[model samples]
Each structure stands twice: as C-alpha cells, then as structure tokens.
Target: MEISNMDPPTRAGAVETTPLLEGDGKRSVQAVDVVPMKFRDMPVAAESIRKAFEDDPLMEYFDAADTAPFPVSRRKLIDMVDWMGAMHQERMLTVEGGMSLMKYGPPGNQTNLPSVAFLRDSLGRLRPEECAKRWKEFGAKARELVSAAFGEKVADMMEIQVLATDPDAQGRGYASALVKYVLRQGDADGRDVWLLTTSAYGFYEHFGFVTVRSGKVGEDNPAWDGEPITLRIMHRTARASLAQASSEPKSPVMYTV
Candidate 1:
C-alpha cells in the first residue's frame, strides 16, 4: 500500500482541530482524537474495519471460496470483530473519525460471547449449513497454525486481532496513535502481544514487533490459485518497566490524550 500525507500534531487536551490550514497545496493540518470506545460503537468500528480490509489478503481469500455468495467475507469479518469486541471490552479502541483497533487476551479472559441475536443479524439471510464446511476448514487450519506457533501457553498472551483505518482518514496519524496505545497497554500489563498479518509487516516492525513464524495460508485450497499466500505471525516482548525517568524523557511516540 502507498503511504499518504500525515496530519500535523496538536496540543494534547484539545478534542477538536484548528481551522483547516493548507500546506504546499498537497496536504492540510487537522487534529485527530484517539480514544477507547464502548460496546455501542461496534457498528461504526465494524464498518471501518470492513472498508479497510476490503483488499486484505485474508478477506480476499475467503471471498474467493466456493461458498462466497452464501456467506459474504466482509460480513463475516465485521461479525468476527463484533464478537471479539464483546469478548474483550475495554481493550478495543476507536480513533475518532479515523480508525479502530480490536485485541483479545487469553481464552480464559473471554468471559462471554456475543448474543445469538447479534450473531444471527451478522450472518444476515445466509444459512449456517451453507457455510459450515468452509468455516470448519478455515478454522481448523488457522487453529493448528496458531497452536504450532504459540504452544500451550497461548492463554497468557495478548493478540492484536484487528487494526483498521477508514480509507478516507488514512493520511492522518490515527494508525500510529492506536498502535502506541495498545502496545503501551500490553507493556504496562507485562504480556507479550502477538498478531498475524499478510501485509504491514514493516509497519509493525517500526514499533518493535518482530516476526516469530510465517506460513502459507491458501495452499492446496480451492479458494486460491497458483502459489499460496504467505501469512506472518509476529510478537512483541513485554517491557519490564513501563515508565521513563523525568531526566531521560523519551521522544514523543504519539499523543496520549
């Protein structure tokens, strides 16, 4: 993906941006707000993710499946995000007018599932029987890969499941801010953060995440053609200390407020 022009930084406590200021006629300046959102924000979050992941490898792979018409890939992704948000509440963050990030802790941390009504609505008019076979095939392969990568202690780690920005808001700094917040949360809690990405491997590396393992995703599956797509699993180790000394203040990574 191509990188777009970024918005300029602003004062920390301001929620609204200053009047539009043009720069070189190529870009403009505006303040963006990044905050943790509540459950009521899922629909907007889901839409943002669906739009961002429209061209994503994983979503495209699913869309190419034989049962694609019966079960829409984007809809499934939106529902998955909703279910994950329900499982991991406060960990989900939304950037005002820009992007959203959803993460999940260990299985033990998930106290409940999304409601049946919500799930039904997410699936829309599609029948479960039509998609069951493909779902099982995808789930089994993904689970096996994850299990092989993390082993028995997977329950103790954090997973960055979703990080998406509205296409219209891509030029802004929303992605960077959301990433900083989640990484700090993981660091403060002293838990390793793991994620799987087919693209954006370099983007994550800028913030200290490193690849742990990589493998083919669509190999031997009818959903794909020719060579299989590569999927990378990355991990970031937890920091022993979350703070810096006043005398040795680090360069600002992102706006906190």
Candidate 2:
C-alpha cells in the first residue's frame, strides 16, 4: 500500500517498508510503511488495538463482569484504549496492520506521566466497576513483577507497553516489522528493552527477548472460569550502538533485554 499522508506526520525520514503477504504466504505486490504515530491517528489506531485485543485472555478477564450489550462494551473498550493511546501517542509507532506503544523511563522518560491512581480512576469511569478493580490488581502485580525482574535498571529501560495487530491482518509480518523497528531504536540508544506478555512467547523469542520471570494472574476470580493467564516478563539486553557495531568485526550476538 502506498504511504498515506491522510494518517498523520511521522518522524522525519524514518519510514521503513515491508511487504504485505497473501493467503498463500507469498509476498503481495503491495507494501506498507511502519511510521511513528501522531495524535491524529488516535481514533483509527485505538480501534485497531481494541479489535486486536478483543478476545485476549487478560482483556476478557477485565470485561468478564460486564453485562452491557456487545456494542456498548466494544465502544467502552475502544474509549479506554483511546485514552491510553492519547496519553502516550508520542511514544507510539504504527503500520497498516499493527501498532506498538512504548515508554522510556529515567534519562529519556516523558515528563508528567499519569499516576496509577489517576489511570485507575479513568478506567473506572470507562469500564465496569468490577473490570476497573481487576485492572487495578493486575496492574499492581505487573509492576511488582517488572520491578523484581529488572531492579533499578527497570527505570532506565525502553518498555514495549502495548503491541497489537488487527485479527484480520495477522501473519502478514506487520508485528515483526514493528518489533524490529523498536529493536533498532534500542540498539541505536544502547538501551535495554522489555515487555510483559501473556502470549506470543515464541514470537518475541525470535527477536531476542528472554523470559526473566513468569506469573499467573486472575486466579480464582469470580468472573473468570478459564485457567489463570500466564504472564511472562521478557527482557532484551541492549546491543552495541549502531556506530560501534559498524566499526567492530561482525559476530553473532543474541540480543536480550
């Protein structure tokens, strides 16, 4: 697909093109560019993210207690995702099929980030009370796990906060392209990268993230009948800077956060 200026502006001259694949696993004639997201992309990007995670275990767990109609629930979820997208739009990147949300702490951290209590309150207004409670608990546990896994370094690493691709757009290499794009940034800055995921373990492993810890969430919850979700904390250590790598002899080095 041709790059569309209708979406929004991207980082100056930082676009990367990747082929779109056909059902038969062959490359299509068209290609898509992965670009940095801007405020104008919020509506479409939020919809994509909401649809992408519509059936996710953790998301389902959050909405388990909702009794609203499907459309209502979907709209609420979209609104919640949009709020998050807006809050971190500057740190987001997107392609035709997927988007990645990132957060940099310490040296490169954004100023005046929202607090946990503020986020929870906002979520409560957008979703069911029970759902908000579950989110609060889950968020706390995730923060604890990340802190334990990375210690002080956690405050200085690049975090892949949300990565999603529309269901209809899967298996077309969109997600891979986004991951590689972030990995390049990490390498360029010589900064470690990490994320928490309940699925896609093998997929992320391909990009050099190793599971530093795993934990169960939503255990014995009244709203959930399914087994507890297994959340893994994956880390990719910073690679040599692009300039440093170019000057040194080439050698295989597994990238880990």
Candidate 3:
C-alpha cells in the first residue's frame, strides 16, 4: 500500500511512540497504554510479531511448512518486515496493514504440496515439548507488544499478527481492553470488525463477532482458508455498530478457499 502526504513529525505534534515498556519495578505485571506503531518501528514490532506466532501451538504446525521446503518459504515471506514496516509509516495505510497484512499471517504451515507429509515424517526424531518450549518467551512478548500497538485493528480482517498482553498481565483486562478498543475503532471508521481466530473464537463472539464459513465469506484471505488449522473468521454482526453494509452477498458460503 502506498501513501502520500503526511503530517510531518514534530515534537509536540508527533505521535510519541514508545513500545509499551512492559513489567513494573518488580518485573511483574504492569499497567499499560496503547499507541500507534510507526512504519520504521515495525522491525521492532516484527521482531516481537515473529515471536508471537512462534509461540503459538497451531502456528508451529504452520511454521514447519513455512520453513520446510525450497519454494513457498522463499518468495512470499521474504522481506515482509520491510514491506510491512514501510506501510506503517502512514497512519491510514497501517490500519489496513494492521488488519490484513500484519496482525495475523505467515502461519508456519504452507503445505499445498508435500510439506505436511514431511512434517509427519520428521516428528518422530524430535521432541515437541522441548522444541516448542524454546520460543515461548519471545512469542509471549511478541503477543503483548503487537497487541498493544495494533490497539484497535485486531478485530478486523481475520488473521493477522497482534500482541494482546504481557505474560504477567493476562486477566487484568488487557486482552479485553485491547479487543474493545479495536472494536471501537471499527465503529469509528465505519468498517466491519474482523478476526481470524484459533484461540479466541467464542471470546470474540461474546462481543458480537459472528463467525463466517470460508465458502460463504472471504476466500482471498489465507487465514480464512483454514488451510492447516480451522481458521475461524468473525466479523461484526449486522447489529454491531461497526457492521459493514455491502451490496455483495455477505454470506460466508460465497467465499472461496
């Protein structure tokens, strides 16, 4: 996405962005605030973003495919940080990025070919617990940071990388706070809230995020394709303040895998 014309960065006028410094003096859960993550700042966010997906159990299955072979891994994910970070430089473009491109993607599973079989063949040689344990910290931190930054966009566009809360800060309303914030943004922008969820489907539906069957909804979204995992896409209900009005038939059955 390309954007031209922006408010020049200045002292008081600039959006003061600091990755929400997590942890209090005790190195325990801390209170937090949300802020816009800039384009230049995405490398920082990307580092955290990569970690978030890495820690995910389902994502590991996807990553085995992502990092496995010679081809799919080579092209699409290459230089993603730079590609995405550049868009974040603009406030407007980043919202779309935050929704579609950044918040939830790059699942490890890319098996349209033989990678799944390969992953099954290799599972016996390694220990799943030991392997997945290694990246937990980075992944956990990534979740918190990106969620804070995405702030209000996580509820849209199905799958996207996003941070929710610090490991120590869960259950203190950070995730709920963040979700509500994103939903409010959707309402403000007059756009439907979307999310591709594995862990939080029921949670989001509680907030009126109704699920759509891929065949009836968005086929263009890989997250909604439910390739390796059952990727559930939820959007604002017609009753939601952020519900989108479209002329196209809006049923999930209209989607293409």
* Best-to-worst lDDT order: 2, 1, 3
TM-score on alpha carbons, each prediction: 0.67, 0.70, 0.41
Model 2: CA > 4 A from native: 1-32, 68-89, 97-107, 110-120, 241-257
Among all windows of ten consecutive residues in candidate 3, which has the lowest summed lDDT?
7-16
Which number leads on TM-score? 2
Residue 236 alpha-carbon offset, candidate 2, angstroms: 0.5
lDDT value, candidate 1, whole model: 0.52
Report lDDT (CA) for all predictions. Answer: 0.52, 0.56, 0.35
Q: What is the lDDT, from 0 to 100, of the residue 76 in candidate 1?
A: 45
Residue pairs clashing in model 2 are 1-31, 235-257, 236-256, 236-257, 237-256, 237-257
The worst-scoring run of ten residues by lDDT in candidate 2 lies at: 5-14
Q: Over the stretch 1-257, how does candidate 2's per-residue lDDT look in tens digits?
A: 01110111110011112234577944443354777665555666556666666666776676676554573446545444443533564565677623432222223442323453355345455556676667666766666666667676665677665576666666666766666677788887877888777666656665567778777778867767888876677887778753443344432222222
Candidate 3 residue lDDT tens string, 3-59: 111111000000111222236611123443444445554343333334334444345
lDDT of 1 at 36: 60
Candidate 1 clashing pairs, residues 3+ apart or interchain: none
